[model samples]
Target: MSNNNLIKGSLQTIILKLLEEKDRMYGYEITQKVKELTAGEIKITEGALYPALHKMEAEGLLTTEIQQVDNRVRKYYSLTKSGKAEMSSKMNELHAFIDNLHRILNPAIDPKLNL
Candidate 1:
């Protein structure tokens, strides 16, 4: 499959972490922030992002505010109480997964027990 499949699986965690740090962000802002943070290594598409945002909003994990910016209206998303709690849980899960993946990819061998 595509590398996006890997990003897709972790999209929720990525968004949650970003919102946690930034407090509030608009859709395009979120995408740009991710690209900036990853130094152009990753890009989040509108197709994947909006659906995830909608789903999180439906689940009560996010709250939105609409404001008129210049001539356009922008919707900003911030984490709700539930979202903060979920963010903590998701962060722990992601960390553990990363640690496990790292171990698998770079196995450590004891010199005394070299196989």
Candidate 2:
């Protein structure tokens, strides 16, 4: 599977978790942060990131602020109260999914079998 496909599935969780850690972030900032944190393993393109951000805003999971910096307007995204509440749930879901994937991919060493 392509890295984009894998990242796409967890994009929401990734964005929410990042916002949870930092108070607010702009689009480019989010993209760079992810690259830095993952050591270039993942790259979030504007094509993918903006659509998701707009969707989350429509869903009331995020709010935005426009700021002028370096002679340009930057739209910063921050989690809403509901977004913060949803982060914990999303994180737990992601963790559970990862655990399941790990088990399936490593059945010979499955912890459930004490192997």
Candidate 3:
């Protein structure tokens, strides 16, 4: 599996977290921010990003604003009230998932038993 595949499941959580940090962001800006934050370890492609954004918008988890920038219209996304609540829930779930994965990957053995 590719790195993109690994990021696929966490994409929603990632996007939610980013938007939580920033009030609003455009598609390209989001892709760039993820690259910068991850130090190029993960790259979010347009194909993957757009569909996710659209789905979230349809689900009322996101609200969009269109603005004119240099004669071009850019759509910026911000979390709705529902989205904020969802973000908190998703963040908690992601944290628990990471903790579980860490435990499974680096399990601790009983000191007395030394198994």
What's the lDDT for all of these models? Answer: 0.91, 0.92, 0.91
Error of 1 at 104 (Å): 1.1
Q: What lDDT tens digits, residue by residue, belong to model 1 across residues 1-115?
A: 2389999999999999999998899999999998998887899999999999999999999999999999999999999999999999999999888777766676784434323
TM-score of 2: 0.90
- Per-model TM against the reference: 0.90, 0.90, 0.91
Candidate 3, residue 75: the lDDT equals 99
Superposing all C-alpha atoms, what RMSD in Å does each candidate have to the true structure?
4.0, 2.2, 3.8
